[model samples]
Target chain A: MKTLVVDYQAGNLRSVETALRHIGASHEITDDPVRLARAERIIFPGVGDAAHAMRLLAERGIDRVMRERHAAGIPILGICLGCQIVLEATEEGGAACLGLVPGTARRFPSECGKVPHMGWNTVRSREDHWLFRGVPAESSFYFVHSYYPAPESEEDAIAWCDYGIEFAAAVERGSLVATQFHPEKSGEAGLQLLRTFVEAG
Target chain B: MLQKRVIVCLDVRDGKTTKGVRFEGNVDIGDPVEMARACYEQGVDELVFYDITASAEGRGIMIEVVRRVAEQIFIPFCVGGGIATTDDMRAVLLAGAEKVSVNSQAVRNPRIIREGARRFGNQAIVLGMDALADRRMPSGYRVVINGGRVQTDLDALEWAREAERLGAGEIVVNSIDADGTRDGYELEVTRVIATGVGVPVVASGGAGVPGHLVEVFTRGAADAALVASMVHYGEYTVDDIKKVVADAGIPVRRQGARPEAGPV
Candidate 1:
């Protein structure tokens, strides 16, 4: 299956593409919403500021296409800032987001061990999601952001990690699956997680 | 619990992993990508690749080398040497590197740290500092650049504080005095910077034995330690070093071990 890695001029698309290739999956990195319209699976991988990313996505009309795709039951995976933009809003720029997932991204309080919480940390599985089938609970994934998304409903949370406070590490609802960590840069267990998602298609 | 990290550093010149004493009389070690794979399999937490041949012309080729290494290894790795601007950081990050380290360039243009951190987020940028023992300096250590060929007026402690203020996510502290001596880390200098900086500090250079790792992680107050000679000389594997570190009552995640991490 050909996967569309939506590139709105933000995020680590190259690393995500490398991860997909490592799993023997074919993917196209593009910013065109028209091409994404035919996507079998769309991965909204991101890094950088959520407000700016949302603007870039809107400029290319990709946000609309993404919403349409989600409504059609197509699988979409979001990572870090990609996951944040899917929420209703983010505190980074006091900006509104795609609203695909009902939540808001808030910055981790300075009282947290570290603001960005950079490096490896454990993520706990909240449910038996296909994307984490073989990924053992407590598996450490790479995280590099200060702001984190808090899903409006607890039921949407599939995995969680803590820095200053307990925040959504991975959220799932119907066909949407998102993680705040960079699975592409994560190690062997992370590869297993990518393989599970790629093979699920 | 956040586990202490054991990072293996590879000094690459012309795409070949090389080892040198005090940054001179370098000898080719092996293929960097292959060596990186071997180290990862042995349970290294991270890898830092430094392109020793600081040339703009060779960077294009070095990026390909980084791409190949990223393709082969699953763990996060950092690229340092010759990174001068935000665009240079982008070029390497886009090539699949997880972090970019700036040393000489960061000194010449301190804004590069803020620019890189702003463009790529703080965690993606690392400040590589080469420091030498100096009694004349207020901090008792001076910042050295250009591969230890030139000493600067900047104090090691003060520069580290400035780097953090400008938005560096991590600091890799290398002591030119203890470098390659394998006697151990410069605990005095390392403790000064590690305690002074808000960001995580990685201790680099002068690691000889498992005991040194313990010393740096404990008394040195380092968040992580970068090893080169001890592992490069084939006296120890990444696992052996980690086992030694863990045996000393420090927490470390064994590579590919049970991933179940409980809320501790």
Candidate 2:
């Protein structure tokens, strides 16, 4: 299956591309909505500010295509800021996101040790899913963000993490799978997760 | 819970990995790209590449090396050592580095921190501080630049706070005195900065053995430990250091026995 990595010019798309290449997955990175709509899989990789990311997505009309692809039930994956932008909104810049999932991205409280919550952290799977296939429970994933997504319904949360607060680390609804942590940067576990996403089902 | 990170710092000079004692007496080690891939295969948590000789012309060489490493490794890596402008930061990021660290340039023009943070989120910008213990400074540490040869009037603690205010996502507190000594991390200064800053603090320099990493994470309150001489000189592998740290009850990503087909 061809994987199309949605590039909204948020931040380093090269890492995601590199990860896909390392896994030997056939993938292409593009901002063009045409490829996004036609791809067998969509990996929305993100970084940077949420407001600016949303602005760029709207300006390029990639937002509409993304929503369309979601509606059609295409396999969608969101990483880091990509995960945050799919929520209803974010406290970072008070930006309204795609609202594909029922939730809001909230910033970690200043008292939460660190702002970005960088480095390695455990992501506990809430239930068995294809995304977590061959991935052990409580496996650590790399995270680098100030905000974490809080899904409205507990059922939508596939995995959870703690950094001062127990928040939704990974969420799933239908064919869409999103993780607040960067699986692309999470080393072996992350690569395995990506490999499963590409090969499983 | 967030686990402490074990970062390998590769100080590159003329496309080769190099190390020195207190920023002097430098000697070339090996090809940076090869070393980087080896570190990745050894399961390093993160990697930092500092173009020690980040001259105008050397920039191209550094970017190429970064690109090569990025292609071979999937983990988060940072590039530092002469990123003066956002354009330079963009070039490094575009080359596949996850973060761009600013040291001497950041001290010279504090605005670059804000600008880099504004353009590329604060998390993408790290403040690489080279500090030395000084009784004259209020924090008992003075900020040194130009690979620790130049000392400034700015107190280490004060500069760390100011840099954070200006949008530095993380601070790497490298002790010049402890660097290359392999005794242990300068715990006092590292702890002061760790507790003083809200962002994650990475203790750099002076890591002789795995015990130093454990001490830095616990006593020093560091979120991560950056090692050089210990691992670079083949004295200890990244796995060996991580095993000792994890044995101390610190939650490190245990992938030593992780198989290619097994659950990670």
Q: Please list, in the order the candidates appear, how each scores on TM-score for chain B only.
A: 0.93, 0.94
DockQ, each predicted model: 0.47, 0.74
Candidate 1 per-residue lDDT over residues B109-175, each given as its tens digit: 9999999988888888999999999999999999999979998899999999999999899999999
Give the Å error, residue A194, model 2. 1.2
Each model's backbone clash number: 1, 0
Instruction: Work out the iRMS of candidate 1.
Output: 2.1
- Candidate 1 lDDT over A22-48, as tens digits, reads 888888889887899888788888888
Candidate models: Cα lDDT each: 0.85, 0.88
Best by DockQ: 2
- Among residues 3 or more apart in sequence or in different chains, the pairs in candidate 1 whose N, CA or C atoms overlap within 3 Å are A138-B261
Docking class of 1: acceptable
- Model 1 chain A lDDT-worst window of ten: A110-119
TM-score of chain A of 1: 0.96
